[model samples]
Target: MSFLQPIALLGIALAATPILIHLLNLMRHRRESWAAMMFLIKAKENSSRMSKIRRWLTLLFRTLAICALSILLSRPMASDESSLINFSNQKPEVLMLVIDRSSSMQKKFLGSSKTLLRRGLEEFEQFSKSWPESKLVVIETVFSETVILDEIETLFSREMEDFFGPTDSGGNLPFTINKGLNWLEDAEIGHVQILVISDQQESNWKIRENEQLIRNIKDKIDSKEGLWKLRFLKLESAEINNFSLVCKTYREETDKFHPTLLITGNQKNTQSLAVKINVNGKLSNLKCRFFPPSTTWTPAISLSDQPPKGWIKISLPEDSFSKDNDYFFTYGNQEMLKVGIACKDEHTRKFITAVCNLDPERIFLNETFSLKSKKLKENDLLMIQGFSSPEEDSQILKFIKAGGRVVNFPDFDGNNKPQTFQNWNAIESASKNDFFQISEWNRNQGIFANTANGRELALPYLKILQRKIPKEGETLAFYKDGESFFRRKTIGQGVVYSFSTLPNRDWSNLGEGFVLVPLLIRIFDESSESPALKLLECGESASLEYNELTPITGNPNQKPSVNAGIYKELGKFFAFNRKTSESQDEMLNQEEMKKTMSSNHILWSEARANSLSFERAEIWNLFLIIMLLFLLGEGLLGLPAANFSFGAKRQ
Candidate 1:
């Protein structure tokens, strides 16, 4: 037996109190053999012996009663075998049904047309009906509103059907359990029985230990004193084969927009798949093949010369689950890069102008401006040819905070001071003889990410005439003397790149090397667009910064709504769908789940097509009953023998 309140067992020492008292009573009496009245003494001794034996029996009963009471107060719970003990007299005080309405639950398995969620709910209904007096609380998902069932007949109604309807949102098992714990805390109930019905997908159930979410659940249940029983009814299928489509990206080639779709599945050999596109109220089909057992095939659809003016809907072949089969996309015209040069020096201006207006493939539209120019847009890249003071013009810092990138180059005019938010610090200038060579560099990131033949190509064999030591940020390129050559700092939505030396030959040989062209282009690209893709899961909220667009299918712009589809917001597009990781068919078995959850109060059952079951049974109340029986026995033993015989005829 496990004791919930092990500290209460210390009261068992009180059982020795009855034995000690009985011994003291015996000590108080003395055996005196007097010959004055022999017959009287003998008769008295016999009566005294009988009285002493009765007192001893009563003491034993009281001690046993005390021990039983201590055990009961300690809240002793029986071992695993106690589940076999039938407690039909006891009823669940709180019945909680936590259902998973993720997209994966809609998969129809063999031998049944109903979805996994449907079958699981039907099994729960059957079990709940057996205990008609149970108070039910339904939690569909972590995001779902908590519902209290008023009537038993309402379990299978149309309203409940919608509550358990299909959804494209993914499920977080730990978060759902936390919600249930919150409800259980406020509920004024006795014994709680929570039924969690889910497909038990590994992506959802395999909560990481470091997450602290599952830890909260374990701690809450452990502290409940075994008042609640958590049962997971894992629904499984016979065969697992699924396919999904992911909207990857949009690429414009030859002035035409093409939408790329990544088709992924676990088919055995090769399977033919259909790609459907609905545009201008006309439907078109394209065929593709999946070379399987885990293969990804990417196919692109080129739009016509006119392009799609309205929202476009693309769909793949329908499978058992259609939540992730469709995608939405809208094409906006290509945006141009705006560049602002803050350099007034004629020599520096000439170099910057030559780089910005390079050829027929010209990308950046350049304009000359001061640091306080009103023409500077938030998205424009402000390239300062010489060092600028953040204190001289507060507008420079304000422009950066408003989503503007700054590229600062050293002018060596002795007016240089470290910016407030920039990570680097200004130190003593390098000596003339102490020229530093390239030591370390982060070639795989930032501006040098795609440098051609980066590993084989050697950096310019040049020495810095003067440079400053960087105090922070990633050292993209370092000098042999432990000074940073180039550093990148991220502040809010914008970035600042600091070069240790000037761009001209007088300070460094970087401009004469192959790094200049790609460096400028990468900076322009970073300024024009965000590098991160805005892929979202269903039911997630859009950020306030992005311009919300209306979906074509429904009025998704309604207040307080979570709808899934493609959306074009401001400079980027959002492709929201079910998380691709949740599509894996892997699941945790019963034993595996027990170890993962690490809670003794948890019970698990696999409610297959035939039967439903509950595993763990509580035995705390049984200990209480045993204690009461012991008390009754002590009461009967404490009564005198003459009192019991008074009811009978006097003999």
Candidate 2:
């Protein structure tokens, strides 16, 4: 049991008023002696006692009424396990508000500029103003973790101005809700109410995959046994006809730059949208027509004459959501790398050159060395197909430290086995007739971007007669037998890659198939673009190897740089936009929400909800009813004498 207004309990002293009045009346009365009065006093002694009992009964009813009224005025809230005697006054309530400040909450109505977040904050301000005595703690859903904005004491001090500011990040409701519940547990307060305010986005609240987590949270609240209250304020939605540029993939085709864009629209009727592009500082526009449940438009932009190397900007017409309308891309002209291959056999040298796919002028074989000046250059990529002695190893290590990429293929020459190399040891080979299949590869990385079309990569059928493993490098691809086939090592500013087997028909089938061409091309492309360019979402942070990034727009001191634009550091360009997942329009309906939450939790629509509707166990009306019943009992007990007098007169 708890009291919302405990000061009214002082009225309980009025219960003694009836007893004081009765005692004072007894003292004020003086006994007048008379012959007839003395005789009647003795005979009617039993009657006097009965009349005193009736008076005492009336006084008891009046005192009980006063006590009930006092409790009613105190606004006591009692649980099912609580009684009047068990009521306490120390359970001060802490109102914790978890609000969603993501950009998805910026959807506004058709005729008004007010958004869901704006209206929801207005309703929350009104509700919080009504509870000036309660301590408020506010947590906003952020990109990293749940951020505590306003502490409990600040709300009590009447210093709150804005409930939530504009944000560029998307909401993460599950993380924030769990954080609030944990804070309540640590606080150990008697009365707590968690008020969640959001538009009920499925991207925010759908945790069907985390069923056990949801069950655990439900059990925690039930363990409190009515000490905690969970309530939700669901915001309403209006008409939405939003179009967004999901993403764009840029590539070099022939001597020109080619770009393909993926655009998604969510609307009821067909709409015309203007698409703008700035390629190599040349501006152009394309008109797109879309109709939807979900409609995707794929448009290709091709440059006939090779445009000058520069940045590209794609944009869409602004609507209710302006965060996802723009995109940025950077392109560079191909600079053929000078590559050299050191191999003992002619077949291996030709195979390496075929995989590289570079022009003949830039591709050279080290086996045809005719002079001492024909050694590997510092800026050239060196593919070593065989190893000779410790002196050769020393020269390769020195070349790697000078900012060069080294792709080493295992060598099995006369008297020098693969295990003779330092820092590496080769065990006995597996069954000779058995095959090795790639089991795992990094998907998020661009190296294997086109490797997998489904759940698994359709790799070439290859059988390995010999395999060598590295001792110091991260494995990028693994075989079915849990052996590494490809590994990467970093030395100074350069990188080294070790391929367990050479791309030869005698050792493996990977050389005879179609996987070697693009794989080699991508490696060259990735090597040329050292420290690859990334397109990040707005809420994420960037860590660069060089401190040369300058903000072209927006404040650099402000984290996350909510404004979408292009940033340049040194000669490289980066693109940042709002989180792509926020473009989804899926939401949970009322019945779905009911199934997702526990029975102890309550949900209300912010469109028609108020603060007083969720008050705990309102017993003031019950106390008023009890007071009226006691009043009726007092009147009925005092009426017995009148009935007896009427009966005697009638007789």
Candidate 3:
């Protein structure tokens, strides 16, 4: 047992004076007698002893109340003293808070109340304020890892303020928690209290070791006089349904644009869902039935018409928390992705150059010499006109991964291998229509105005190269006829587009004028511009605006194994990750994460129940104390009550 203020014991010394005075009065009255009232004195004598006993009991009760009140004021408590210190107002205490800041937290599940974080943070803040001068250490966990946010003994310190920011929204949250536990070994204090505030979605990570580790930590803290607290907040959407346009891709192989969308319907109806989309300001409604009942849906919508400044949105009905419902993504400007065609044949070079439209500077036609792969920046999109198999080239794969598009056009002069895609019989018989060519009407009626009477444009396709494409997702476009005319597949976290046909009209006339510009532009520019905070997609990732993490093993020139993941080497691309990828793997995009997270957003208040584990013994001990007090009271009054009953019966 310990008290916040031990000096309050002086009150106990003062309590003794009253009891001493009462004893003196009783002794002085023992020899006093008056003969004038013998009969009256005899009558009062019987009740006098009873009255004195009652007075003593009343005084004792009053004294007990004063002592109890004083102790409560001093805040006496029993807890571990593992973290002892010599500082003023400081007892032994350890408090650890685990905060989840994954991208999903972007959803305001707390209604218009407090945010998940705001609620936990406020509890800690208020507790610290009351304690005033006590030690506090904080650890932030996301995706099974922990970052020591800050530690302080003073309530509102600068370190505490600086440490508050967006949570890490990533893969396998248990790992983040494990990281936090391991890092906590550095705590300079002894007694510790572990508090976890999150959605409690670790069932998928139900490893026995993890479960045991959590219990072990709690037992240590409890044994040493520390507390364990857990506040779980469910992330089910309550008042709002949101739709996000995650990402767009261009399969240079197929010469098509594929856009992915993530929709969440947390409405009263858990059956079916529907959503509407807007592309470059053009609107269309899409519906999903409970025939495939699901709470969340990920759908890919293809655009037939190439909107110059591609703007797209997927939206559900708006709610008071409007940031999540409707999302906007701008397809980067519709411009030709410059291509460098390397071939020795002049005719093949000219044909490939004519198939694209960009500033003359973006076009490189050559029967020329070698180019250093590294210097080939910005306009790195390349097409090998000759029938060369780049299957062995990992560098080309890296190019596509970096967002640079690539197209391989076979040479018509007999040097190129057309058979690499598929048989010619397949190309001769296939469905040739634009993305909007559903229900017989060409969706690009206005955009393809120049070629209303002509056949569909030529999109070079190829049989998917297995090694070049990672097994991340599905293959969106396939071959036409026999040999694959055009195909799009993701490669090593990059995109690869392949075309099996030549660029000249010798194969197809779709390469005519305006269609060529839009087609070429679609393949080169795969993503949208800087979008509003609310328009971010689910698996789509936005990186920090500043350098935070970097890789060492891959980039040869950089220094090895940095202690803190920060450095100039982190370059510019570190702040991007997809919370919406099909795999649900975590990405590290914290730069643009919001900092002004507030509490008035979470619904459940922690002033009620915020405990991780409860010891049965402590509770039973409290009950035993109350029972013992009851028995002592009975013993103190047992004789008097018996005598009163006997006297009443005789009367």
Candidate 4:
């Protein structure tokens, strides 16, 4: 607690204030002869007033002295930390860079030579050259518009690796920069710098917390005598039209593709663009279509030849973010999604097994399956002819949770004794109106638009006397009256699809249809969407990929990354397949939701919605200012009560 001045404590000698007043209670003066008495009384009154003034001055001086003393003891300070800590001389600063590859960055003002990121990186490189041994810590951002996870070596230096290309087409403009700055914890003072190279898109740059964190770090560095510089390399060019594809996916169960293609650009209206698709590197098809900007275009993609290879690519012949004009992904193979059915009983299991093919080894027969975490490997759709036992029911639920899928017929026949497992009783309906079916209208739909050898479905006739829908039932096949024939629901991650009618000739003849295999394959495809599946609808710009085998890679923790090529036809709107990731058993707490739902999940969804909204911090600051104003108003209101009442309002 060193102080600039220690002598200020001497002012405490004035603390005798009130004591001095009491010690010398002056005797009241008596008037003597006329003139002398009057003068003496007046002198005494003057002395009394003077003493009162001295007492107040003494009290004020003592208080001031105490405050000064505290100040002297406290040793109030401003830090030289920022500079002193930088004492140990260091080499050039290393920066981790994230450059923007948005189409806007590609706008050319002078000529083809300069684009946003190109220029920004150039400036960054130049800046680094000025410092000795200044290294790049880590740099990974889409350039030219493609998302690339740089090999670890790429973080070293250009001499260590040389990989440069335009970035992929999509990056949500707003960023989460915490991942960038967090790595520099306790680095050599002034030895590291975070250089995020971007064009400073207004949408991306306004994260106040990011700025505050940087400022705090700078302040701390200053206190430690360390050098901290927030160097901004603003890269900009004239904004231009940007048409990007946001999303694309295929529904295997339906043998269909539904892509939500988004286009954002200067041109708000629809424009004709050619979409080129290659199936497994083989040139497949090219079509011209009109796409409107800033809207989702659900497009249908079909192949006339062998179904587009698992790997598909879509390209827009033109767009600024050209590096990402196409994307590639392989859908689960139809063969991989089938379950070979081989059940025990003739009345229950045998009958259902015939409904769809499942192997004895792969079948969901008993409870031991999921204790091992082996979700029923419904490489294909599961076919359960008979109702499962208590053990089977529990296993089925676990399988569903583990991602096994099944389409089954629940037997509730009077002739066929229904199966009962603990909580669920499969009761057959004798009512003539009980049977529900998938009408011919649904069967004949042009669902396989792009498939060359696509299945032409024939309805299955399953009249198994079955139980009513469960509380968690899903009506996949419904009757005209809206009752379910096929009630599919999740038992966990596994899918439990039940049908009331049996599969054999005695029941409805649906099991012996040409479409049976195809329909079953479709179910498997639908269920496998449980992990890393992409969906796209009709009229949407979609890219198809056939990179590998069935069973899309299920890396739950590995970031689900989609590479949309230079155009909007590629992987877009890389939405993390949320349904697959969330726990089916985890219910959204409505009480918690209600607290937020008054504003319609405003804060919850507003974050991902990418909608333009006011910053909450600014709102809170305004609230603080309002509170301060209120206090100021209260203080002002009291001014009128004082002796110096603000000149009374003219009566």
Clashes of each: 0, 0, 52, 94
* Number of colliding residue pairs in model 1: 0
Question: TM-score of the candidate numbered 2?
Answer: 0.57
TM-score of 1: 0.52
- Provide C-alpha RMSD values for all models, in order: 11.9, 10.1, 16.4, 16.9
What ranges in model 4 sit over 4 Å off? 1-112, 133-138, 141-165, 169-183, 186-191, 200-226, 252-260, 268-270, 280-291, 294-302, 327-651
Q: Give the clashing pairs for model 1.
A: none
**Residue pairs with backbone overlap in model 2:** none
lDDT-sorted candidate list, best first: 1, 2, 4, 3
Give per-residue CA lDDT, model 4, range 312-426, as digits (tens).
5566667654533444445433233335453432654554444334544223334222322434553434555544556665665555556566655544433233333112334
Output the lDDT of residue 130, model 3.
Answer: 33
Quality of model 1 by C-alpha lDDT: 0.63
Off by over 4 Å in 1: 1-84, 88-90, 152-155, 160-162, 187-190, 253-255, 298-300, 305-308, 333-536, 543-576, 589-593, 614-651
Residue-wise lDDT of candidate 1 within 1-651, one digit each (tens)? 345677899999999998898789889999887788777866577567887777677777788778878877877654332332554335677688888877778777435778887787776775665355778888876365678888755666865554656666667676777788787787756777788888888667634322477677777777876777777887876464567776434445543446645566767778787788765335778787766643344445555654434345678777766766776654543456567777744556667667788732535545545565565563467777555666534666676666677777655565546666454455345466776677666443346552332342244465666565545454577677666777776565566787776656666566564666567766665555432233445643332233255444544552112345655545444545565555566675657557766777887767666544432334567767776776777677677665243436676
Task: Show where candidate 3 strays beyond 4 Å.
Answer: 1-10, 19-92, 106-112, 125-133, 142-168, 202-256, 262-578, 581-651
Model 3 TM-score, 2 decimals: 0.41
Q: lDDT of candidate 2?
A: 0.62
Residue 609 error, candidate 1, Å: 2.6
Candidate 2, residue 287: CA error in Å? Answer: 1.8
Model 4 per-residue lDDT at 587: 23
lDDT of each: 0.63, 0.62, 0.40, 0.41
